[model samples]
Target: MSIVKNDLADNSLNDPHRLLRNMIDQVPDYLFVKDLDCRFIVANEAVARIHGFESPDDLTGKNDFDLHDASSAARFSQIERQVIRTGVAMIGMEECVVDAASGKERWLSTSKVPLRSANDTVVGLIGISRDISARKRDDFLRDEQTAILEMIVVNSPLHAVLDRLVRLMERQLVGVYGSILLLDDGGTHLKHGAAPALSQEYCGAIDGLPIGPGAGSCGTAAWLGESVIVADIASDPLWKNYRDLASRHGLKSCWSAPVLSHDGIVLGTFALYSARVRHPEPAEINLTQIATRIAAIAIERKHAEDKIRHMAYHDMLTGLPNRSLLTDRLTQAMLQTKRHNPWVSVLFVDLDNFKFVNDSLGHTAGDELLKTVARRMENCIQPTDAAVRMGGDEFVILLTDLPENTDAIAAAMHKIRAAILEPMIIRGREFHITCSIGIATYPQDGTDAETLIANADIAMYKAKEAGRDGFRFFTPELNIKAHERLALHDGIRRGIAQSEFHLLYQPQVELEFGRIFAVEALVRWNHPQLGLINPNEFIPLAEETGLIVPLGEWVLYEACKQNKRWQDAGFEPITMCVNVSARQFHDQNWTSRVMHALGETELDAKCLELELTESLVMRDVNEVIATMEELRKVGVSFAIDDFGTGYSNLSALKSLPVSRLKIDRSFLRNLVEDDDDKTITAAVISLAQKLNMKVIAEGVETHEQLTFLRENHCDEVQGHLFSEAVSSTEIGKLLQNQQSRSGLAPA
Candidate 1:
């Protein structure tokens, strides 16, 4: 648009309006003036050109409706009227106006002022506007991109984040298509990272592309540790082999950038694809680099999360399910079974003598064996079943969806037992491991995860008690028996601590004289809760718990003191016999403890006899022989108690430094009725004689039993046939009576 030269010269020299007009023409911003009728009165070259007019003379008389569409004209008129009536300036108003020159909507930052006449009345509005479309568009895109990235970081997982990133880049670039490829763990190949817009068949074809020179844009980018832009896939040697694959997917060009870690190590490649043959602009290349950086962040985060989760749920040694995951899976299995009414068996398996392996071999070997067991157990169960390592040699298998029957559960357990029994070579030695399995089924043994697992563990102990290399099913009776055994163990421990034990003496009479020569000290538990508990009930429990060591010491001291007291009272000096448990016999301080008891009581060692069961003596024969010799040197005699019950060899028997053998009560009770017992008892007597040991027959309840013992030349007899085991006072009376009856011999 042109300004009048005379008016401009006049304004430039003297008029302030002429100077203002020249200044407005020098500015690039669109400048205009409108009348009260909303018609353009004055316009600069920039405003006239934007309205498709050659000069201001062509645009001056046009109204807002002449330059813009009707809707745009109405909006402009409304704002102009408000400015004119209020006589206030409207500043920095933003509007979307259709450019009359291009017919394209452009965002503008505009200002309007109410022009007043000399009478101080509003005459029209003067406007100043600038095209801000590019700035506004750029700002909007940046905010949108920042929001998308924030959402990805906060909510999306690794792969999903990568997928969203690629999709967003594609949308931002309009027609550009892209994909993300990650380096495999081995760093040898490119794997499908994310390509949401790509077809599955195309992704599959390019998924495992090797990372090397001439291996396509992504592969080459990863191989070279830089960006690779293939202007034409069909012609570029990098895509020589992959050209046909790319062509088939309608991709003609590809640009790839290596995704790098913070240390600049190549993590993967990000690529943009195009259907038309072309090279990427600098902006597109930068976009790919940014996408690659984001992909690396997402992938590294995912890997870290996976590693933590894996460690949480998996056994570090065996790579089997740990207790935490096992419990979770078991709970799920139980829930499923409850809904479907199918049997879900929880099998608690403990490798028998696993400690022996760890003790004999090192824990390294033990770990190898456990890993092998995990693999074997895995092989035994179905894919759906979970094999869990419940820590150290204890494993549980959750067998799901089995038929509701014992047979099905038994079959599964059989497979597991067989699998574990298979021989393994550890530390160059062939070894075999046996496992005890306990099966607890859903809705039968228990209903919940904890109950089922606990019951299964309880049954496993039962299997161990029955003997290892076996399996047991959980039953209500087994549960009762388990609780009873636990209570008995506790009771035995309490009884020892509280000194609830008292000794009763069963006289070992001289068979020929019919006189009480010696007495066997038998322990009885004076339970405050259950009166007079038998030795059989708690003795084994005491041995198992190692309480027998202290209990045996108490018995020894009590018996020796009682014998010394009788001697002090001017009664007959009698030898005292005290029973020693297997655990007590194995105590390294056993001989010392025995001597200490004798010393405290001031009883002669010759008058103290320690009776050990043959089974106990037979175990570690050399050790037992040494122990016997130690006691024998101190003038303490040894007797193999319940001699015939155990399978101690006769040769081993001869080596023991013993003075007597007590026939077990079983043989004595059935001596006349059972010929087997008769033969065994007779053989025991003969064996004792050959070994230079005296024989004592216990439980001689009848005359026939005593007659059999007497005829067999048994040295001592102790049973109800003479008198039952009696308290200390009762035994004193019996000793006195026996002394009086010593004048008469047996008929």
Candidate 2:
């Protein structure tokens, strides 16, 4: 289209300039012409609308600088100057432009072409621009959404992403500021997640906002798990508590959407606040929903990550740090030693007799006891110290910055003991549990966590060996003993497998008839290198290492075999007794094993007896009774060994299918010297007679002790007074002598 001469004055239909103006006015792309001096000569309707002009004529005589910001105007001038000077067109130049009509930031894709006179000289510039502001805004929002997605995927801190999200939301919607509120851990309260545009005081006032009905926009949204739009906060009942606070912060209209996980559980809320009182438009509501979904993803992902982290570092049962976390913390503590030179003490604790609780009261009560003890242990230490359950009845305390003197360590150990021994009532029964603790200090007990923990464990064993209910510090001697104990444990394991364990039978004589009644088989380990190791030295260790189960089975089989050998050798078929450890008795299949042993040896079940300690029998009496009944059905008898030394439940004992009760040797050792021993011996005999069970006094060594037991009507005696625990051959000779003395001949 071209402008004709005298077109401004022409009234005819063939006015070229008027025709060009009419054509350009219908085009949506902005069209304008500028003279050599950069003055706007003509513009189309699109350009006029953008420039806030009523008509194309209103832009006439205006330069780019007059309509655009200085930077944009300068760039436009340079481009137009180049087009006018060089007759070159600049095409599709993207630029940030200030919209003259609304004074808003806009993006435009602009092209400038030179205008030529009839003489072929560059006269002015003609520019066509397409407003691309909406595309630019959409791209910006897309980037923001991408960033949010990255934050969720990479496990970035949730708050940082939410803060970025609210900022993006505020910038996207004019006259709207945004906030995000997250549900607290308990899911009963809302905490301020991010509110950059809102005042800190306003955020503080709304933080810890309870999630319930009528709890303002975000709180109510979270509580209801739905969107809540308040046209006017001043009048909305939901904002009654927060209206004044919002008014002070110049917030009026509020719209909120619950941030919900895919499972429909509310995680948080996304909200927008307007200074003006008005309902949210459809577009604003849609934005709120989009923001809420993003917020939900971030919140849920963070919660899941946190839960996983907690599970990794924490014990599920006691909620204390697990081995993994303990190792990590101990490593860190060791690292800190070089800089601060502080003492780091590791206390290894083993709960004494904890198995009794599990056996007697059930594991449920045992668990309660452990958790309660864990709490008490935590209370005994400083807040900076850590107490952790190192799995089942074993705990460790990491103490930092302790004194050089041993007093503090001793005091802490004492505190731990006292705390554990404090009477705990569980399942309607009171219990006093004891713990053996060992202490290992940094720099002295080795420099690393593993060494320190190992040493502490070594000391713990020392404490237990010292009779338990105590604590011991790691010493040089303990290290040697620890190594020896380890060797012993290995030896015991090998002995059981290699059949290195042998039995020593002590004949139990019928006091009235002077005939052999039974022989108790005592296990003796003939270690190839260590020689004959007494049961006292290794029996407890076997129990601790869970070696007792297999070892006990070996003893049972060996005792049954030896008894069968005696019977085959034409000796009396007296009952052969085997001692059972608590660990062996607690084995669910113990009765079956005994039957198997008897079956394998082909020994008469009537000639076999299983001896259990008072404590072991009292633990889970019902289970003991059931086991005893099963054995009794096969004619196997039961004996309560170490009778008065353990906490025996007399009532439960009455229900046991026991054939004999053996008085503990400790009572008999002082039988003549102590009146208490004499009285206990007499009382046991009387009780056994009343229950139709024979009483046997063990460890009898002198005439006075044997006379006391006989006068007390003890049905049998098994001690040095007759013979010590001797070899099978020695016992065979003694059995022969006893049978001969009783006027019987051994084939």
Candidate that scores best on lDDT: 2
Q: Model 2, stretches more than 4 Å misplaced?
A: 1-23, 84-88, 116-123, 327-345, 352-385, 398-435, 441-452, 467-470, 480-747
Q: RMSD in angstroms, candidate 2?
A: 20.6
Any idea what lDDT model 1 has? 0.84
lDDT of each: 0.84, 0.87
Q: Give each prediction's root-mean-square deviation over alpha carbons.
A: 24.4, 20.6
TM-score of each: 0.53, 0.56
Residue 62 lDDT in model 1? 86
Candidate 1: misplaced stretches above 4 Å? 1-28, 42-77, 94-107, 115-123, 131-142, 157-164, 167-174, 181-215, 222-225, 240-251, 263-268, 331-343, 353-369, 401-415, 418-432, 481-747
lDDT of 2: 0.87
